[model samples]
Target chain A: MKYRNPHIPEGINVTKRHPLKELLILLGGALLLIVALSWVFAEFGGGLARLIPFEYEQALVPDALLSSDADSELDVYLTQLSERLQKHMAIPEEIAIKVHFSGDDVFNAFATLGGNVLLYRGLVEQLPHENALSMLLAHEIAHVVHRDPIVGVGRGVGIQIVLSTMLGNPDLNVLGNAGLYTQLYFNRDMERAADAAALGAVHGLYGHVGGAKALFEVIKAERDRMGDGELPAMFSSHPLDQQRLDAIEEMARDNAWAGSGAITPLPAAFADWLKTAALRTESGRNTGNTH
Target chain B: MIELGIFLALLTLGYGFGQYAERRHYRSIIEREKRLNALPAIAARFPPTEPQHHQALVIGSTVISVDYFKRFLAALRNLFGGRVTAYESLLDRARRESSLRMKQQAETLGAEMVFNVKYETASISKGRGNTIGSIEVLAYGTALIRPQAADTDR
Candidate 1:
C-alpha cells in the first residue's frame, strides 16, 4: 500500500491574470461609473432646482454673506452699474440685484443666490475702464437672471450626496476636490452663456461691444501675474481668456454689432472709492461692527 | 487632491511589496512542500495496521494576513459583485502552508503516515470595520509511527 502525497500543479487555486490589467479595468470602470453618475445627477438636480421659485432662492440666501460695504461711493457706484446692466438684461421686476463691494483684496468677483453679486476690491481695482467694469457687473447679473447659482449649488449637493453614499464612507467627502473641480467645469457653459448675454447688454447700453474684452484681459493679466499653475479650461469655471476673446470677436461679426467703439473710461474717483471701502472694512473689523 | 495623492501612494506601496512578498513566499512554500512530501498526510479516518504502529497527534497552524492591496481590491470587488480573486491566493497559501507544516511535524515524530487529517479556518477581526485583519488555518491529524522509527528519529 503506497501512501504518499503526489505533486499538485501550481496556479489551480490562484489565477495568473496580471494585477495591473485587472487594476486598469476596474479603475476605468469605477471612474466611468462616477462620471456618468455625476453627469446624470447634475442634469437632474439642476433641472429640479430651477423649478424652485426664485423667491425661495432669495430666502435661502445667508444674510451674513450678503453684507455690502454700504452707502459709500463704491457701494452706490456698483449698485448703479448693476441697475444699468439689469435694465439692458430685461430681468424680472420681482428680482432685485444687490451688488456688494467687499474691501478684501480677493482678486475675484462672483454672483450667488438671491440676486446677490459680490465684487472684491482686488479684482475691481484692476479694471482698466468703465466698459470693463460694466462687463463684469453685467456678467454676474446674467448669472442671477439665469438662475445659475441655485441650480449649480443643487447639482453640486446632489453629486456630493450620491458619491458619499457610493463610497461607503459618509464622513469622507469622496472625490471632493475632483468633484468640485468638475462642478466648476460644468459651470463653464453657464459662464459662456453669461458672457454672450453680457456682451449683448454692453452693446445695447454703449452702442458697441468694445472693451468688454477688458474684463477678461484684467482677469487674464491678474492670472498671469499670479504666475503659472493655471487650471485648464475643462477644470475651470470659465473658458480660457483667449477663447473668450476670440468668442467675443466671433459674436460681434455674426451679429454685425459694432466691434470697435469709444472705450468708456472708469470714474476718476474709482480708486479712491476702493480705498475708502478698504478703510471702512478695516475699521469695521477692528470695531467688530458691520462685518 | 492631497488625499488622492496619499491614496495612490498607499496603493502603489501595497502592491509593490505585497506582490514581491507573495512571490517569494510561494517559492519558499513550494520548496518546503517538496522536502516534506515524503511524510504522507491523508484525510482518511483509519490507517492500515502494519508493523504494530504507534499513534500520536500532530498539529500545525498558520496565521496569514491580507495585504492592503488585496483588501482594497476586495473592497472594490464588493461594489461590483465579482470573484474576489485578490483573496484567493491569500487563503490558498495559508491552507497549503498549514498542511505542509503538519506533515513536517509528523515527519519529526517518525510517522509512516498520518490519518484523519482535518483543517479549520477562521478570520480574526480587530474591530477595523468589516475588514479582516488576518486568518488562521489549523491542520491536525493522527500520526501512525513505528516504535523503532520513532525512537530512531529522536
Candidate 2:
C-alpha cells in the first residue's frame, strides 16, 4: 500500500481575482448607494422638519450670542434696517428676526435656528452702500423665512443615522463622507432660493437691483483676496459668486426691474461704529464672553 | 480631514507591504514544499504492519495576522454579503504552511510517513469586534519512523 500526499495545485483554494480591481468596484458601488440614499433622506428630512414650529426652533440655538452684538450702535442700525426690509418683504410677524452683528473679522453671515442672524464686521465693513448691505441682510433673512436652518439640521441628522446604521465600522469616518457631497447639493439649492427671495426684497426696498450687485462684488473681492473662489459651484454651499451675479442680471431682465437706481449711503458714522463694535468685542473676549 | 488622510495613508502602506510580504512568503512556501514533498503527511488512520515502523506524535503550528488591506476588503464583503474571497488566500496559506511544517518535523525524525494528519484553527482576536485579527492553524500527525532510524537518533 502506497501512502503519499498528492501535490495539490497552487491557487486551488483561493480565487484569482485581483484585490485592487475588487476594491475599485466595491468603492464605486458604495459611493453610488450613499449618494442616492443621502438625497432621498435630505428631501424626506427637510419635509418633516418644515412641520416643526418656528417658536420651538429657538431651543436649538446654543448659548445664543445675542449679547455679543445687542448693545452696539452697529446692532441697532442693522436691526432697524432689517425691520424696514422685513416690512417690505412681508415676513410673518410671528417670526421675530434677531440680528447679531459680530465684530469678528470673519467674512461671512448666516441665519441660524430661531430667526437669529449673525453678521461679521469683516463683510459689513466692505459694503459700499446701504442698499448693498440690505441685500446681505435680506439674504440671511430669507433663510430664516424658508426655515432652512432647522431643515438643514434634520437633513444632516437623518443622513448621519442612516450612514452609521448601514455602514458601521471604525473606517466609517472616511466612508461616511459620501453623505457630505449630497449635502452640498441641498445647501446650494437652499442658497439659490434665498438669493432669489433676497433679490426681490432688495428691488422692493430700493426700487432697483443696482447696489445689490456691489454686495456680491465685495464678496468676490474678499474671496479673491483670500485666494479662494476657484471652487466649482457644485462643491460650494452657495452658488459661485460669478454664477450668482449672472443670475441676478437674468432675473432683472425677466422682471423688467431697473438695473440702476439711487444707491442709499450707510450712516456717516458707519466706520466709527464698526471700530466701537470691535472694541466691544475685545473687551467681551477679555471678560471670557464667548460669542 | 486629518482622519481621512491617516486612513488613506494606512491603506496604502498596508497594500504595499502586505503584497510584498505575501509574494515573498509564497516564494519561500513553494520552495520548501518542493523540498518537503518527499516526506508525505497523510490523513489516514492506519499504517502498514509490514513496514514494522515505530510511531510518534508530531505537531506544527502557525499564527498569521490579517493585514489591514485584506481586512478592509473582507469588511466590505460583509456589506455586499458575497464571497469573502479576500480571506480565502489567508486561510489557505495558514493551512498549507502548517502542513508543510508538520512534514518538515517528520523528516527531521527520519520518519517514513506521517499518518492520521489533523488540523485545528483558532482566531486569537475573537470578541474584538471584527477588526483585523490573527488566526492560528495547528497541524498534528503520527510519524512512522523505522526502529533502526529511531535508535540512531537516540
Candidate 3:
C-alpha cells in the first residue's frame, strides 16, 4: 500500500535508504581514510619539519620555560654543559639550544618544540658523575638537532585535523591524546638514531664511551628499585636499557676505545645543595600532611 | 580475543536495536503526519486567512535518544572528520515527530490550522559520560479555532 496523503506534497520520502547498507559503507570508508591519512603523515612528516623556519620554531617555546640571564645555579650549569656539547656536534647554525630544569621529582627528560630540552631534578640528582649527565643531555640535544619535536607536533596537529573533520566535532582532547600516544610509539626508530648520535658526541668530547653506558645502568637500577616491569619494545619509545648498554659496548669495541674512564664525582657544593633541597621538600610534605 | 568478542556483540546489538527503533519511529511519524495533513502547517509569515474564533497556543515536544551503535559510528566519524549521518536522522525524526504532535493537540481544540509554527531543540543528558544522551525538540504555534459552522467558510 502506498503511504501517501492527497493533501501533502509528493515525492518527499526522507527515510528511504537501507540503514545497515549505508552504515556499513560509511564504516568501510571511514576506516580506509583513517589508515591512509596516518600512513601519508608518517611517511612525509619528517620532510615537512625541515620546512619550518628557525624563527617560527623559537616562537613555539612557551615564555614560562624561557630562562633569562638571571637563571639558577642548576640552570646555568645545565646551559653551560649543553653549550659545550653543542660545540662538538654538527648542529645547524640556526638551532640555538636552551636547557630548562624542572624541580619536580619525575626522573625523565624530554625535548620539545623550539629546541627546548627539559630536565627533571630527579634525573639530575641521580647522576653519579658529570659525564653520565652529559650522556643524558647529549641524547636530548640530538633530538633537537634533528628537529624531532617539530615533526612530532606536526603529526599531532595533522591527526587532530583529520579526526575533527571525520567526527563532526572538534573534541581536541580525545584526538590529541591519541595523537600523542601514536607519536610516542612511532618515535622508537628516532630514539635509536638519537642514541647513536649522542654516543658520537660524548665520544668526541670525552674520548671514551664509559659515561654513555653508565647513564643507562643508573636508569636500570632506578627501574629495578621501583619494580616497574619492562615495557615491550613495540610499545616503548626508547630502546630497552640492556639493549642501549649493549649497543654502546659494541660501538666502543669497534673503535678500540677503552669503555672504562676516570669517573668524576658530582661537585661537593652541588651535592650539598641537592641534600638541602631534598630535606626541604620532605619537611614541606610532612607539614602538608599535618594540615 | 575476549575484548573483540564483547565489542562485536555490542555492535551487533546496537545495529539490530537501532535499526528496529528507527524503522518503528519512521512508521509512527508517517502515519501521524498523514493524519495531520489536513491541518496544513506552513512556515509562511502570515496565515492564509484570519480565524473566526480566538487563536490559542498549541505545543508538542519530544525527547529522542540514539542507540549505542550510532554513538560508536559518530565517534569513528569524529576521527576522520565528516558529516554525522547518524545524528542527521535523529534530528529529522525529532523535528517531524514534534511537529505532528503539535498538530494533534491543535485538532483536539477544534482548530482549523496552526500559524507561525516555531521549533526549538536542545540536547539533554542521558546519564552517559560526555556523550549526548538525548535531544529534545519543542514545536509550538498559535492554533486558529473556528466556530462550528464557520469551518466550511474557508
Best by TM-score: 2
Q: Residue-wise lDDT of candidate 1 within B33-56, one digit each (tens)?
A: 888887888899878876788899
What is model 3's C-alpha RMSD? 8.8
| Cα lDDT of model 1 by residue, A1-291, tens digit | 778889999999988887778777776676677777877888888899988888888888877866876446777777787878777887977788888888888898889999889888889888888999998999999999888999898899878776776678322233455556657777988999999999999998899998998888888888899896467776667888999999998998899999879998888888888888888788888998864
Model 2 Cα lDDT, one tens digit per residue, A1-291: 887767888988899999999888887888888888888888888889998998888876755546555345666788889988887775876787888888888888989999998888888899999999999999999999998999999899878876887688764457787788688888988988988889999998889999898988998998898885458765577888898999989998999999998889999999989888888788888999877
Q: What DockQ was computed for model 2?
A: 0.61
Backbone atom clashes (below 3 Å) for every candidate = 0, 0, 10
The C-alpha local distance difference test score for the whole of candidate 3 amounts to 0.73
Which candidate tops DockQ? 2
Candidate number with the higher TM-score (2 or 3): 2
**Where does model 3 exceed 4 Å of error?**
A1-32, A42-46, A59-64, A68-76, A169-182, A221-235, A240-243, A246-257, A275-291, B1-65, B73-154
Model 1 off-target regions past 4 Å?
A169-182, B45-59, B109-114, B130-133, B142-145, B152-154
- Each prediction's TM-score versus the true structure: 0.89, 0.91, 0.57
Give the poorly placed runs of model 2, Cα more than 4 Å off.
A62-65, A70-72, A232-234, B1-13, B49-52
The lDDT of each candidate is 0.83, 0.85, 0.73
Error of 3 at A148 (Å): 2.1
TM-score, cand. 1: 0.89
Q: Tens digits of per-residue lDDT for model 2 on B69-97?
A: 88888777777888888888888889989
lDDT of 3 at A60: 70
